[model samples]
Structures are given as C-alpha cells and as structure tokens.
Target chain A: MSAVERIPILKIGDVLLASIQVDLQDRDVLALQEDLAEKITATGAHGVVLDISAVDIVDSFIGRMFATIAATSRLFDAHTVVVGMRPAVAITLVELGLTLGEVRTALDLEKGLAILAELGERAPR
Target chain B: MTAAREDIPIAADEDVVRVRQIVRSFAQRAKLSLVDQTKLVTATSELARNTLTYGGGGAAVVELLGEGRRQGVRASFQDSGPGIPDTALALTDGWTSGRGMGLGLSGARRLVDEFDLDTEVGRGTTVTVVKWSR
Candidate 1:
C-alpha cells in the first residue's frame, strides 16, 4: 500500500489551481473533494482550475468526484474548470455517458486559467 | 517470450487502486502505447470496482501474451457472488442495478480488443478481456 497523498491546491490571485499529478486512490480523491471545498471557503476564492493534464485515465468514480467538486464549488459561487483531459479519456468518458455534469473544460492549464479569468471578469462583483 | 500470470485480489477500494497500479506497470513493460495503457488501466479499474462493490469481492488475473508477431495483455475478473440476472440488460448502456452510471461493463468492452463474460445465477461471474497491442 502507498502512503496517503494530498493533491495540492495553490491559490493564484482569486483562482485556485489544483493539479492532480499522481494516480489518486479512491480515498485520496474523496479527501481532495473535502479539502478543496474547505479551501474555497477559507481563501474566499472565486474560481478553481483543476488541471488533470497528467491524468491518463478516469473511471466513473473519479468522474463523479469531479462533478461533485464542481457542483460543490458552485454552491460557494466559485467556478470550476477542468483542464487537460487526454483524447482517450475524453472518448472513454463519453462512452461512460458522463458529461462531467456541466463542469467547464479547457484544453490546458493556461487556457483553464484564462477561462477562469474571463468568468471572473464577466461576473458582477 | 511468454509472459507470466498474476492474480491480484480486489477486496476493497485500495485493492482496486492496487490492481490499477499493477496493470499499469504490466502495460508499460509490455511496451503498450500510452493510449493503450490508459485504456487498459481504466477498464481494469472499472471491473475491479464492480468486483468489490457488487461481486462481494473477487480476484483479477493479469496475463501478458506473445505469439509470433502478435502480443497483448489479458485480465480476468472473477467473483463468487450473486450473479447478474440479466446479462444483456446489464451490458446495455445506462443500465445499472446499483447506484452507478452503469458504464462499468459496457464501457470496458469498448476499450478492449476482446471481451468475454461468464455468469451463473447462485454460482459466480467472470469477465475476461484482452487488449491486443496496436
């Protein structure tokens, strides 16, 4: 068994960037969901960029985790953007009939931050 | 060279993760492309989850195959639990008896090069799949 790993959540400006760099266990993902929600409230962040660029695959459980995070972030009025999904993962997600539940998607982390910025600018403060 | 076979237990969530990591190393050692590796690992993850959640825990057998110019990997998930009453319906997209998207079986079929399912009510169930190197 591997040691517990916590995905880091970095705050940049008003956007929170969370990059999933390791192959997360189910418990790690569940822990992350809880951690991210708390971070949003603690930091008062407005947007979240979840960069999964290094992720090679996503089962339905992980897919549901992303949706839950996005939905929870919405409760705090924080926009969530998923970034860097590989082509094969995308295809598999579609086959799984998981649209990621209305979570926004971008091609890369740069674009993800850009989208979050745009979302931040358009919303009324 | 013929590859060795391994049997991994899928008794819990951590076991499922363990299976994924083991299959990943196997895929890498088999020289499967990144895309193929991802697909195989993803499919194995889903099946392992099913074995744990629905099958009351089971075992996954991983095998590496090479015959002449053809080479690939095969994984079989076996469970001794209440079998699916309707295999066809279970294979249908968007159909699930439990709380899930029901993509575990059908979606896994799409990712692999070959798929075989064996089940008997009150007996057990086994799903065997193979991914040919591409």
Candidate 2:
C-alpha cells in the first residue's frame, strides 16, 4: 500500500508557499487541508501562495478547504492566493457555486507571486 | 462475454474511469444523446465515490429505461453502510460526512432531470437519478 503524503511548506522571503501533491481523493484530503491551514497560521508569513497545479480536479472538499484557509489567514493577518487552477476545474467550481471572491486566484505561479507582493505592500506592518 | 441487459453491480473500490465506462456502455445501449450521456456519467461517478467513502462500500445499478415513446437512462446507487441521519443537512453545501466537500448529492441532483433519494437509519440508502432525451 502506498503511503499518504502530506503537503509541503516553503518559506521564501516573506511568502509562505504551500504546495499540495496528493490526488485530492475523497479520503485523506480533509486532514491534509486542515494541516496546511494550521501551518499557514503558524508560519506567520506576510502572504501565502497555494500551488494546486498538480491537482486536476477541485472537489467541494478541497474548495471548502481553500475557503477555510482564506478565512484563517485573515485572522492571522496574512493574505492567501490560490494558483494554477485548470480550466475544467474552474468551470466545475463555478457550477458548484463556490465563492472564491475573498481568496485571490492567479493563472500561474508568477502571477501568484505578484499578487502576494501587492498584498504585502497593502498590509501594514 | 455478452453484456447483460439487467443492472450491473460495481464494487466500491472502482475508480472514476471504471464508473465512467459502465455509465457510457449503458447510455450507448440506450441510444442516449452524447450530452446527456456525459452528464449522467459524471454524476454517477461522483455518487459512486460518495457511496464508497461514506457508506463504506456499495453497488451501483445502471438501467436503460424506455417508457412508451420516451427513452432515458436511470442509475441507482445503494449502500449498506451508515445511512444519512439528516437528509436535509446532508444535502446542504459544505456538510460533508467524510472527506468530501458535500457537493456529491447536490451536484448529482443538478446534473440529472429527475432525482430521488430514500434512506432509513440502520437500513441503508438508495439514490436514483434519471436523464431523458427528447
């Protein structure tokens, strides 16, 4: 049996990068999501960049997890941005009525980095 | 082996690909439209995964329906695991029992034209969804 992998966290300058490499299946996604959120809060970074490019689909569980991360980041005074959402996954998210207004989204990692920089500039130290 | 006309029972461990193949085969035999075929297949895949996760494993029934002049496809997922205690709460968005995001049932309902769910505590649960081609 293959072992379940946890998400990886990287601290680069003021940006805390959280990368997810799992299949995001029905099982084991919630625990991974909660762990990522807690890690973001504990890091106390200026902003968070979540890279989900490897994930082909963003089901309701993952989507809700993104929302939770965004909400929790606000409490920690850090902004969260989601990066690398595939077109099909985006359409599915829209059809499912997931509100991603509060959480910023970028087309790629570079765009996400730009957003994180902008968010840091706006936030007071 | 000749494909049977009766319902096909699938194990819970099957992935989305197998579920899609089963749905497509049934829809093709029924001569359903490509659009309806895709929708039904996607919805069935979602529900099948839910059954395995929350119900601890279950079987899906794929049937070709013909009611006089109208022809359609109907698929039902039945599980012997713990039945949903609160149907309304289960249907609500973001209310997931296991690791799901709680959109399987609601999303399945939206994909099909006709959806029916019946469940009883300690008994089990059955979800039947139908899509017609005019």
Candidate 3:
C-alpha cells in the first residue's frame, strides 16, 4: 500500500485553505480530518475552505468526510466551506443521496474565501 | 458481452482507490459520458470500501462490456466475511452497522444502471453493478 497522503492546509488571514490535489484514499480522508482538527486548534482559525475541484469522484465515505469535517470544525468555532465541486461530482453525490449535510459550498476558491470572510465578520468576538 | 476483465484485491484503504481507478478506466473505454463515468467510479468506490471494511477484505472484478449499441462497465465485489443477515436493513439508507453513514449500498444502487446483491449469513456476499453508456 502507498503511504497515506496529507492534504496541505494553508492559512490565509483567519481562514484555513485546504486544496485536495490527489485521489484520496480512505485513510487519507481520516488523516485529513485529524490534521484539520489539530490545525484549527493550533491556528485558532475562524474559517476553513476546502477546494475539491481536482476531485473527480466522491462516494459516501468522501461525502461523509465533508460533513464530518464541517461538524467537527464547528465544535472548534471554525466554519468550513467546500469549494470547486465538479458538476459531475455534484450530480453523482445527489444520486448517491449524500447531501453533505449543511456544509457550506462555493463555486471556487475566491468565492469560498468570500463566504468565509462573511462568516468571520458575523462571528462574535 | 464482456470484452475485457480484471480482478483486484480489496485488502485496505488504498485498494479502494485502485478500484476507482480501474473502474474509471473501464468506464472510459466503454465510452460512458463524463458524468456516467464519475457515477460508476463513485459507486465502485463505495462498494470497494464495503468489501474491505464490512466484508473483511475481498476481491473486485471489473469488466468492459460491449453488446450491440450498448457499451458498459461492470464491477463485482465479493467477500467471504460474515454475510449481511438482513439485506433489507442493509439496503436502507442511513442504516449503517459501522462508521459509515449507511449510504454505501443504497446510494450505490442509485448511481448505476443495474445493481444486484447476493449474501447469506455465515456464508459470504457479492454485489454486482453495471453502468452502460447512454
């Protein structure tokens, strides 16, 4: 088996940006959740943006990972917005009945950043 | 009729990724639309993970089908683990016996053109799915 890959999380202002650039394995998704949680705590960031344009496929596990990440981040006072979901992926997720459950989504990175910024402004200090 | 066939072992998480890749290739070869390819690959990913996690590791067989005007891709996941005792419950959405959201089986059924599940308690399980180009 190949080594589990980690998705890099970059901090821009108060929001953390994680662009998924590889075909993620199940272990990788789990690891990313763990890492993102740690990073959220360490950085004390208020928002998270996940870029999934490169992700061409998503099953229930991957779909759940998005919702799980959002739910987990909320506990740490961080909001997560998924961005750049391919049109085909969106359709497939719908057909699979995985709605991603209340996770905010945007069309791209810039738009995702905009949503995070808006959310950040509304968050109580 | 199947023009080509390949078998892959589903022992770990990485194997699930491999299954997606193989299924995508077969889907592409069958000339499935991009959306169809994505759906089929996604379904394969769910089934492959089920084979590894619930089925205690098994094998996945991918086939490229060509029949008259219908070109398609088919994948069958088979395992010898403790078979699902209640297939009806297992097929219900959000009824997971594990960490998953329970969408694997039910959701996969919606993504493909055909879905078949065969299981027996203490025996084994096999799930076959196919998606034809439209």
Candidate 4:
C-alpha cells in the first residue's frame, strides 16, 4: 500500500473548500472523508465546496465518497456542494448506475460557492 | 489483434490508481473519445478495487487492439483468491458480500463494449472487458 494523501482544505469565510486536483486512490478517499469531518467539527463551518475539476475519472468508490462526505457534513450542519465534475466523468457515473445520493453538485467553483453562500444565508443563526 | 499490452499488479490501493492511469493512457492511444476513455477508466477502477479487496490481490492485463478499422482497449483482471460462489447474486446491483456498492462487475459491464466473466467456486476468477472507439 502507498502512503495516504491529503486533499488540502481551504477556508473562505465559513465555507471550507476542498479542491481535489489529483487522481484519488481508495486510501486517499478515506483520508479526505476523515479530514473533512474533523475540519467541519473543529471550524464549525456552515458549508463545504468540493472542487473536483482536476479529477479525471470516478468509480463507485469515489462516487460514494461524495455522498459519504455530504452525509458526514450534515451531522455538523454543513452543506457540501461538489463542483467541476467533468462531462465525461458525469456520463460514466450515470452509465455505471451511481446516482451519488445525497450529494449536491454544481457546474464549477463559482457556482458551487454561490450555492453554499445561499445555503449559509438560509441557515439559522 | 493486439497492438500493445501492459500488466499491472493489483496489490494495494495505489495499484488500483495505477490500473486506472494505465487504462486511460491505453484508451487514448486507441483513439477513444474523451467520454469513452473516461468510461473505460472508471470501469477499470471498480474492477481493480475488487481484485485487490474481494479477490485478495491480483493482476490486470491491459491491451490496445486494432481489428480492421476498429481500435479498442481491452483489460483483463485475474486473481487467485477464492472465486465467487454465487456469480448471479454477485452481479446483482446493490448486492455486496463486502463493503462495496456491488457495482464492480455489473456496472463495469454497462460501461464497456464487451465484458466476460470466467470464474469457478474455488479456482479463482478472470474478468475481461473491452471498449471500442466509435
């Protein structure tokens, strides 16, 4: 097994942004989920923006990771919006029968942050 | 007809990523479109993980092929681990013997142009899939 890699999580206001710029291994996926959960708890962020523009492909494992991350974030009242999914990746996921349940998605980083911002406004202060 | 071939060992999580990279490159070399390449790589990723986890580690053989005017990428995953006892149930969607979403075989078949499964109760299993350029 190779060393687990961490996806850098950046904070913009109360929203945490995790941009996945590398091809993810299974271990890396698990590490990201753990890291995101911890960050949400520590920072008390209201929203998360997962930017996957650089992700070239996704299987069932990675697809489920999105749902898992969103589900985890909800526990801390954080909304996750996955962004920048490539068209090819989107088509493949649909054909593979993965709906990415419970994971909200957007077209790009700008739109994703917008959604998060809107959700943040709607949340109870 | 095979134009080029590479064998990748699926022993760990990293190997699964390697398998995806190899398949992606081979798909490109075969002149597959971006969507086709993505589909093949994604399907291979699922199969590679199954080889490492359920199959208890294995090897993947990827091939670039040309038949007349058709160019295609083919990959075969083979493992010496205990073979699946119930292939039918194994292929059923949402049915998992482990932690997977049970889309490895069935889902892979959906993404490719061709898929074949050869398995025995205790003799190990081999899954071969192909994606042809359009």
lDDT for each residue of candidate 3 in A15-106, tens digit (9 for 90 to 100): 98899999998889999999999999999999999999999998888888999999999999989999999999999988988888879999
lDDT of 1 by residue, B1-134 (tens): 43478889888778888889878877877778888888889889989888888899999999888867767889999999998889999898888777457788998998889999999998888999888777
Model 4: lDDT of residue A76: 93
lDDT by residue for model 1 (A22-107), tens: 88888898999999999999999999888888988899889888889999999998999999999978876775566788699999
User: Of models 1 and 4, which has the larger DockQ?
Assistant: 4
Off by over 4 Å in 4: B1-3
Shift in Å, residue B54, candidate 1? 0.8
Candidates' DockQ values? 0.57, 0.17, 0.90, 0.86
In model 4, residue pairs whose N, Cα or C atoms come closer than 3 Å (at least 3 residues apart or on different chains), thus clashing, are none
Model 1: how far is A104 from its true place, Å? 1.3
Query: What's the best-to-worst order under TM-score?
Result: 3, 4, 1, 2
Cα lDDT tens digits, model 4, B2-121, are 449999988888899899988988998999999999999998998888888988999999998899998999999999989989888888888887766888889999999999999987
Candidate 1 CAPRI level = medium
> Tens digits of per-residue lDDT for model 3 on B77-122?
9999999999999999999988778999999999999999999998
lDDT of 2 by residue, A30-78 (tens): 5665765677667678788889887655655567678877887778788
Query: Which sections of candidate 3 miss by over 4 Å?
Result: B1-3
TM-score of chain A of 4: 0.96
How many residue pairs clash in model 4?
0
Interface RMSD of 3: 0.9
* Residue A123 error, candidate 1, Å: 1.9
Docking class for candidate 2: incorrect
